[model samples]
Target: MVELTKQANPGGLGPTRVLLHRPPALTSPFMLPTTGESEQAATGERGRARAALLPQRVFKKPWPCEAAFIVNILVFVYGASIGWMSPMTLLLQSDKSPVGRPLSDAEISWIASIAYLTCVPADFLIAYLSDKIGRKNSLFLLSLTSVCCWAIKLCSYEVWAFVLARALMGIVMGGAYVTCPLYTKDISEDSVRGLLGSLVILFHTTGNLFSYIIGDLLSFRIVLWICLTIAIFHLILCIIIPESPSFLIKQGKEDKAVKILAWLRCRRETDSLVQREIEIIKKEQKTDENSSNFALKAILKDKILFRAFKIAIIVALAREVCGAIPVLNFAGDIFATASKGTNFVLTPNQQAMMLGLIQVTGSMLGSSVVEKAGRKALLAVTALISGISMCALASWFVAKSYGVDAASWLPLATLCICIFCDSSGLQPVSVIITSEIFSYKYRGTVMGTAMAAAAVCAFIQMFFFKNLATSIGLHVSFYFFGAVCMFAALYTILVIPETKLRSLEEVHQDLRTKKEKREEKALKEVSV
Candidate 1:
């Protein structure tokens, strides 16, 4: 309720309030891309190019639920396949390696870190290649690489081998991270784009949960086997996955675009949308946004785009610095101590497993609320709550140092709340906003930079969590993290605008053009 007041008031301090109850907003990215059919609409080339390209359309008018469902599952599996890499990173960091030999957590984290080291660059590469080759083919190829990486990871126990494996794994992971969003953005109808794009996170979360659960029971070799199996399945499914109609249209394959639209889309203007999407592709044929220099210069020159980039990096770094990841890695330990000391019913591992499940549930729920509450609302609430929980956890520790005889159950409860807050807000919303901030032109750049920041931050946090936790003491650490997160929450509330329902183009244009108009108007008034 106080947070609600803060929202209405916009800038002033308000009492803490309920955060989940929020209002609806418009969703955007209101058109499709260059479906081959659109090229037909471009020059009425069904007859001319028809002879050269082929009589086959991308979609054949059936619009099979079977096909859509298969696509959705494949998308989810692609996400899960790569996400398995995550828990392994922490394994490298945890005082214990996943495979049982002791190694410096930071050194192992290096392999994991270096893997993501190329993530953004890989994203830029994939985005460009997706346009050049086909989105489907590019992703399928990347998935195959992911399999090799896992096999390497499982095949060897040496640290260097692991490093190389993780690096390749990171490439595939980065590919999944980049291409999945591109696919959803390219394929889904404008009306349901938010839901569809949000599905990326959904499957990602499920993948995360799946990995965590399996990581709990299975050996590292088994996990790699599972990952490999998933990749093979993904590659098999790739043949059915349609090439982006936009790519086809850009190549002057309109007849193909039309048939795909008829089969995949439910709306009536499949033709109109198909053509409109193509024109934008043809209109900018010479000017590819995925150019190497474009991304490089985006961070350097484009002021509006750069501003969005800075926010994304800062926001992302701040998210990691808040220390949620370190806590998740230690949740079992935390829960074990707290619950055990307090005679709680659930075992620490069980509680941890449940916590993972809760995260999956929270993320799913958060996705639904995103369209309703606006990205700002969900982020603001999650940040504040997560901070409060962290602060409470810290306070409990501090109190213990002061010989207050704190209840172990109390701290454990706080840890659970922290995890819930993280799953619902920081992880999901951070990715959503990062992707949403940039338009098609710079999406790859912004996401790449932010992910890079996040990866680095995560590395630093891992290296420091144990040492920092020891030096500061659990209570103090909790308080410190809480303070950091509270500031982040406040930042979101004050600085970030709602992006939940707005079109990517609308948001991008508003960020760019609106600021220019404001500056222009200010100058005129001063002159007057």
Candidate 2:
């Protein structure tokens, strides 16, 4: 049942205040209105309003948020694994280690870096599986891999055993970035989408924190036991949840999709709004089918899609190469220096904990503001601030070289600010915006391609960061990061469109209009 409504009032505060608008009522004049249509439509609208009120009366809790959080806890285990090696590396080098021989530095490097190498190819493989088997099942497969990773660590102490464990972890990493975001977006209502999406990062950071604390206090075998327990736990928990409604509809299980969507939104299957949203999903699926022929080449030829793809890749690369990981890797050394000659200084492990706490806090803050402040604004503000902070840190390092005495706390403060902005702003925003911009037809492919690029960039930065710092200076490396952030900020203001609470078609339409306007302006300037 297609219902036409009036368009929103132009030239006013219309777009920000409401989701419903009264656009022209018919697709065309040939479809004339029938008798009794007006009364039926009015009755349906009231029913939708009543349905919206049921959640307030009965299910006063956010079930979707709870569900998303439950699924994302697996990410915390991944984080713990990432943080696991830091302390474990030191312990393994001691004579009291489980293997009975200290690991060489070259072996340790392979253990740390192998997951990333495997992740590049796994991105495409996992993405294909995600689209083929379904999101829920893909996640179940990821948990199985997670279990294998931890189990290998539990059962063996050989150098090859550890390397194999880390390689399996690479599959988990790829699935987490690809499948988790897509699943979270599909299951969530738009109102809480950003909040729910940010949970992935929040849980990951929390897991890292847990690893640091638990690895410090417990024996090596005990830490392995706990990590193994988490994987098995999520595998069991994910078994009970319903498959995504989008995937259900794609599979032509319309009734199941309706039931799942209704349950997730706390609405009745018969409700007009529920039915309308279902229609939208079905319509999108049909569109995807029609456009499936020659999709890869078409994506390259379509100007708007290509532009959106460019933005997504550039932002993703920036998120990785902007020095966040390198700084986190060396946080202990930076903090060690910052605390020299200071009363309020922290030890290396203590500094790790502090940064972990800050990361979780930033994610929490980002979830809160993403809906209110909008995506473009939050990204621009954070990028500009990050750029300025990097420049300040670079200058402070330069000043200390010429017989100058900067405050001991300056580096610590600056580094914290950079971390805060990254966690709270750029990292999650890049992922959210990427998922929101494209339709489902191209969503999985685009995410996989972008993540692959990001993985390569991350690999280069992780491998060569120290080498570059040695050949040039550390301060110059930071200056390069600062320049990148400034460029990113400029790109956001000039090119990015606000996508707050807008539908997929609406977002595409806005971008198309902007592109046309730019071309028109160019032509006029040439004529003048």
lDDT of 2 by residue, 275-301 (tens): 888998888778777564544566788
Query: Where does candidate 1 have its weakest 10-residue lDDT segment?
Result: 21-30
* Model 1: CA > 4 A from native: 1-128, 131-134, 153-163, 215-224, 246-263, 267-270, 273-293, 298-300, 336-341, 344-348, 509-515, 518-528
**Residue 436 of candidate 1: its Cα lDDT?**
70
Residue lDDT tens for model 1, 308-344: 7766876787677675677766665555545544566
**Distance from true position, residue 325, model 2, in Å?**
0.6
lDDT of each: 0.63, 0.78
Q: Which runs of model 2 end up more than 4 angstroms from their true locations?
A: 1-58, 336-345, 513-528
Candidate 1 global Cα RMSD: 13.9
* Full-model lDDT, candidate 1: 0.63
